[model samples]
Target: MYGIVLSRRDFREADQVITILTAEEGKREYIARGVKKIVSKNTSHLEPATLISFGIAEGKKEFSYLTNVQPVESFFHLRQSLPTLHIIGYSLDALFTMLKEGEADSDIYQLYISYLRFLNTQEQVRLLLLDAFLIKLFSHLGYHPSLDACVVCEKTYKEIGLEFLSATEQKPGFYFAGGGIICASCKAEKQRIGEVAYPCGIKEINTLRFLLASSWQDVVSFPLDEEEYRLVHKLIYEFMLYHSERKWDDWGKISLIMT
Candidate 1:
């Protein structure tokens, strides 16, 4: 079937090694052999974030080849602004790195398309959109954070200080570690590093909770104040890093692009 071009790497002087998020195959990479030919119309149409219909031939194992492609939604607005183009580019790259090839993830494809469409809008709320996109994307990948109740004690985060274990801290700042909170009581039970709780305000936690719990369509239109928006931006970055277990270089850059 056809899909959107998520990412592309130059394979040669005149060809591109690319990955497409297909409805049938999820994410697949192939050599767009000779796509860069001077007279080839296909090469011009395969930009990142451009929706295109592509025919694929299943191969031996864990790979596929592209037979043909037709443009669908080009997301032309993404090209109008450099900062926007960069943020969306990084988001697409993150997806490319995080998703496995030949896996069927229709949900991810839909979320990605939604994110692209949202980004194409002329709203000055780029950071808000980025934060919302991360929360939705991470939730889909099963790395969603515990933003409501205390992850360790299973108690509602009523108090101002909500501690969580820090994965990489020598004297871990809070009880947050590896996707959950380690309560003060639970902290003593474990021999690992621990630290007292930090103040994670109710509003901050609630915003995260709402983002995780709500649908993208519903959440996209939701608004955020500057402080709340900044909290989400930081939380999602930490959440992605903590959950995915990988360092994303472009994430910080995307945050800066919005600023």
Candidate 2:
């Protein structure tokens, strides 16, 4: 089946344990023997984000053994920039963390392939693409945040007059525990009950909504300034962390890219 290599680790001698995400099988671990050797032709096909078609031999153990590997696409351009490479690495790490073994989701597989394709071609908005990818990934995993209205009271932003706020005073008025933006009425209730609410600014909120709702091609042309970029990044990252119940060690380093 065709799949993208997600991660790999050296095993005994020249063998390696490779983790791959496939369109049919989801995330899988395979034993690739002797691929680490210099003479091995499959070495390049096993790198992270390398798209390939391969067959596996079912084994008695949980992990299967790889048989034939034919390369399909390699994102060679990603190797040009350190920052871009790091973002791709983190994206793989996040995908690895969220996906469970043997869980196949074809949508996720397609999304991953699309992400790699975007990184390979687009040099300008890698970070924006990263943010959109995370949002879209979580959405496919059933953690899509409520963007149309308040998650708590179900009031639309227009109903609450959020659009009337000046640029300098726009606040996301988001409550994480509530799962999205908390309307003014719900915000007061949160305060009355002593719950902490974070502000995500109207511009940032609209930008996020746009990202989640827009197509990949549309997102490529979406306008974003430095501040909006940082805001959306922080919001999506935190939202993922809260929903996934996972922490990324390199988040600080990733955040530095936004600055």
Candidate 3:
């Protein structure tokens, strides 16, 4: 079967255990003996962010082991940029964090493959790609943050009449804990319960709507101002972490307020 390497770590002497994500098997772990040796044939194919075709030996022992592996797409271009590497770091973190082992999710697997290909070829490694993937994945998992209406009052975004760059604390904000956008009126009640809502305005809200509604192809062309993109990106990461029950506990620093 073919899969993308998710992560790996040293096992006993000269051996390592690897985790991979596959469409059929979802996420899995396998032992690759002697993988740390200088003559290891599969060493190069084992790197994280690499796609490889491999055979697994269902050993009599408790763990399945990799029998053979051949390189598929190395995504070599990402190696050239530090920022892109960081982006991939956060992306992979989210993917593995949200995915349950031994569970098949073909849609998310496809999105993962397509996203890597897009990142590999595209020079602009914007957070927009990560944003789109997270939103798309959430939709696949059936957990979109209530983007269209206030989670409290049920007012549509249009009815809220959100304004861009409106700096008043009275403005409606994205309460990650609350699962979506909330109007100013509702924000108070949430604050009374101590849920912090990161302030977001029209552009952030609309951009998120467009992302959640569109395909990856369409999201690539969707125009966004720098600040607007950052705000939405922040919201996506925070929403995922919060709703995923802090599965991505390390995915901290999503702003408490959109600056």
Candidate 4:
């Protein structure tokens, strides 16, 4: 079957437990025997974010064993850059955390493939794409964050003028559990009852909406400066962390790309 390697960890001796996302099987782990041995050909093919085709031998037990492997696309060029690697790392962490093993999701698979294709062809790493990918990925999993208006109120984004960093006393922020942007008033009330929001500016909100709703071709041209990039990165990274039940290791991946 065709699948993308999401992650892998060393098992006993030369073996590994490889987690892969397949269109036919969603995400599943297979025991890859002796991959650490020098003669093993499947070692490189199973790298995270790689598109590979492989055979499997399923037993009556809960796990399956990898029989053979042939990589379809390794995203060679994308892996060559540290920035792109961070993007791949964060994206895989999200997928590994959220995807249910043995469930099939062809749409999500196609979405990730398209993302890798774009990154593979680009010279510069557009982190906007990473933000959009996370947004879309969550949408597929039924967690699309409300971007246009307050989740608690009906106020439209156009009526809002305050930015989180500039405004005082509980400014607007992306309420992760609330699944959208909450107005300052609502945020103030939520704070009294013990809830916090991720600070965001007006421009950040607009860019987030644009990223969420627009196609890749259109989004690639939109401008994203360093400061805006940092904010969006923090917002999405934190959102992912919260939703993933704090399963991710920061690894300085987000901070690594900041420089």
User: Please, what is the TM-score per model?
Assistant: 0.78, 0.89, 0.83, 0.83
lDDT of 2 by residue, 193-223 (tens): 8986666667777887898888777887888
Q: Supply every candidate's count of residue pairs whose N, Cα or C atoms clash at under 3 angstroms.
A: 7, 2, 0, 0
Model 4 regions more than 4 Å off: 161-171, 247-259
Tens-place lDDT per residue, model 4, 105-157, is 99999999988888888777666767788878987888888887888886777
161: Cα error in model 3, Å: 2.9
Whole-model lDDT per candidate: 0.66, 0.79, 0.77, 0.80
Residue clash pairs of candidate 3 = none
Residue 206 in candidate 3 has what lDDT?
A: 79
Q: What are the runs in model 2 whose C-alpha is more than 4 Å off?
A: 161-172, 249-259
Off by over 4 Å in 1: 58-63, 157-178, 181-192, 195-199, 214-225, 250-259
Show pairs that collide, candidate 4: none
In terms of lDDT, the poorest run of 10 residues in model 3 is: 250-259
Q: After superposition on all CA atoms, what RMSD does each candidate show versus the true structure?
A: 5.2, 2.5, 4.2, 3.4
lDDT score, residue 221, model 1?
68
Return whichever of 1 and 2 wins on TM-score.
Answer: 2
Question: Which model scores highest in lDDT?
Answer: 4
Candidate 3's C-alpha runs over 4 A off are: 162-170, 215-221, 244-259
What TM-score does structure 3 among the candidates reach?
0.83
